[model samples]
Target: MHDSEDLVVVVDGELLTNTETICTGMKAQHASTMKLLRKHLKQLQTFGEVRFEIRLNPQGSDTEYAMLNEQQSALLISLMRNRKEVVSFKVKLIREFFRMRDALGQRDMTLWRQLQVAIAQEVDSAVRASFGSRLMLDRKKDKPILQSEIHRLESEIQPGLLLN
Candidate 1:
């Protein structure tokens, strides 16, 4: 495997790995892995549909590979014998899924934060438009924050986040 290749990829917004990857990591034959998948195909389908893709091998032959979601992949690995390499690969696969999940969560939070800022800006714009005569604050004198400023500040106060 190449150092830059992703262990898991998002397909239809879900992380997935292919039998080819599993076989490579476990040092198992691709045909045997495909056979195992076919044998338990029904059970695997319970998690999600197993999409098969055909690719041209270096030898100018076509080969089929199954793309399995996290649950299906786990189940398939569990059905395989616990060879040392398989076990090691299983652990690596688990960590890859975990890392992907964490990354997605972080991305979601960032999008949420961005939405908050966008909404806040809209609200602040409305407040500014509503109060044309709104007085500006003087640093030396005591003055209250404008409604627009309040809305802008509120956007910065995300839940569980430290404010600077």
Candidate 2:
């Protein structure tokens, strides 16, 4: 749908997509989509918040669009008068929306694993510094102890995490 453009996006940790996606997917004019949205604006809001943003294009003209959550977007699609094309696009969009949901879940799990590794690395670093400065005559013999601990943890931890 929508020529394979990204149908779903994460904004402020919220799952959302825009009206433009629907317009392109259904092969309808965006102007008509906006008109239908405005006509049923109240009905759309009944499902959830419908957000609008205005951006100045390269030509200095304002382009306005609505950023809708799952329910609002679904209802907006149902509101369209045409069905033959809209149905297929609507189905594709819904499926893609859920696919993105699962991907987000996987991302959260990966971040949690990364945090665990980072904590382990911090502990390893602290242990190394402390033992290295100790007044032990057999420190040379115990070098492998630190190596073993680091291996138990992992090879590396990224200095920072990425946020979306």
Among these predictions, the greatest lDDT belongs to 1
Best by TM-score: 1
Model 2, 1-164: lDDT tens digits are 55433887888666898887788788888778899999999998997788999877457888888999888898888877767787888888899888888877787667668657655655555666566556243444454664554344343222243221
Clashing pairs in 2: none
Per-model TM-score, in order, reads: 0.75, 0.63
What is the number of backbone collisions in each predicted candidate, taken in the order shown?
Answer: 0, 0
Give the C-alpha miss distance for residue 32 in model 2, angstroms: 3.2
Runs of candidate 2 with Cα error greater than 4 angstroms are: 46-48, 56-61, 120-164
For candidate 2, the TM-score is 0.63
**Model 1 misplaced stretches (Cα beyond 4 Å):** 1-5, 133-164
Question: What is candidate 1's lDDT per residue for 1-164, written digit by digit as tens?
Answer: 52213668876567999988888887888999999999999999999889999998667899999999999999999988898878988888889988898887787677667656666655555555555544222321212233444444444444345443
Cα lDDT, all candidates: 0.75, 0.74
Model 2 gets an lDDT of: 0.74
